[model samples]
Target: MRVHIATDHAGLDLSRYLVEELVAAGYDLVDHGPAEYDALDDYPAFCISAARAVREDREAGLDSLGIVLGGSGNGEQIAANKVRGIRAALAWNLDTARLARQHNDAQVAAVGGRQHPREEALEIVKAFLAEPFSGEERHARRIGQVAEYEATGTVAGRLEELRPREFPAAREA
Candidate 1:
């Protein structure tokens, strides 16, 4: 599987560590920069590029996933989710990481470096990589609900195409 990772200054060190780990694990990796650290560098640009690469490649039927890291991962995930077809999940622990992949079929994982120790972060990432989507009926149904929301800006179990009518209920009465 191919993995792409991107981050700004806050995550630079962790990102570099992950690169070495992933490369050693024999997975193809794409590392989006700050090739050299810049304190003022922004996260969204790098995160967006990496996240977009994964979505586009996956849409083209390439087996790929992405990682966006930051001081807290909140901004990175939010930016990644802005790209249509990218389900980015923030992973704080092994269970959450696994569930993000198993239940949501997320293609991008957001990691918060400042929130967890290096070992714990690595474990969470490992869990994310190891888990597969369950594809069970319930999981599929829930994912479908999210997909509908993504595509239509609404969700299932909500009123559809509500039309305002003055006293329309009078006819029914």
Candidate 2:
């Protein structure tokens, strides 16, 4: 797999560690700038660059993924998701990380440099990298719904189409 990694100054150390781990694990690693950390350097530049590379490869029907990191990972995730084809997930634990790929087929994982310890973060990354999309019909359908929403900025009727055929106008509660 071609894995692209991008991180701001806050995540420089962790990002360096990940590059080493990824290489030892035998994956092609792409570093998307921020080679030298600068406190004034922006996060979106690296995150979006990584996302763009991954998105471009997917456009050509190639397999690719990305990891974007920042202090809290929120802005990084937000920026990565701006790429139309990028499904970036902010993963906090093993379950969320694995499920991000398994259910959402996420191409990019947004990890928080300050959220978890080094060991836990490593585990989360490993879990995310290891899991494969489940491809169950329901999961695919749900993912499609979300992707459509992201692309068009509007929810599809397919979702409302699945609502209960009949229901009381008012909630029982």
Question: In terms of lDDT, which candidate is strongest?
Answer: 2
Q: Superpose all Cα atoms of candidate 2 onto the true structure and report the RMSD in Å to 1 decimal.
A: 4.2
For residues 26-97, what per-residue lDDT tens digits would candidate 1 score against the true structure?
Answer: 779999887988999999889999989998888889988888999999999999998888899999888999
lDDT score, candidate 1: 0.88
TM-score per model over all chains: 0.87, 0.87
Model 1, position 123, has a per-residue lDDT of: 80
The per-model lDDT (C-alpha) reads 0.88, 0.89
> CA RMSD for every model?
6.1, 4.2
**TM-score of candidate 2 relative to the true fold:** 0.87
Residue 4 in candidate 1, Cα distance off native in Å: 0.8
* Clashes by residue pair, model 1: none
Q: How many clashes show up in model 1?
A: 0
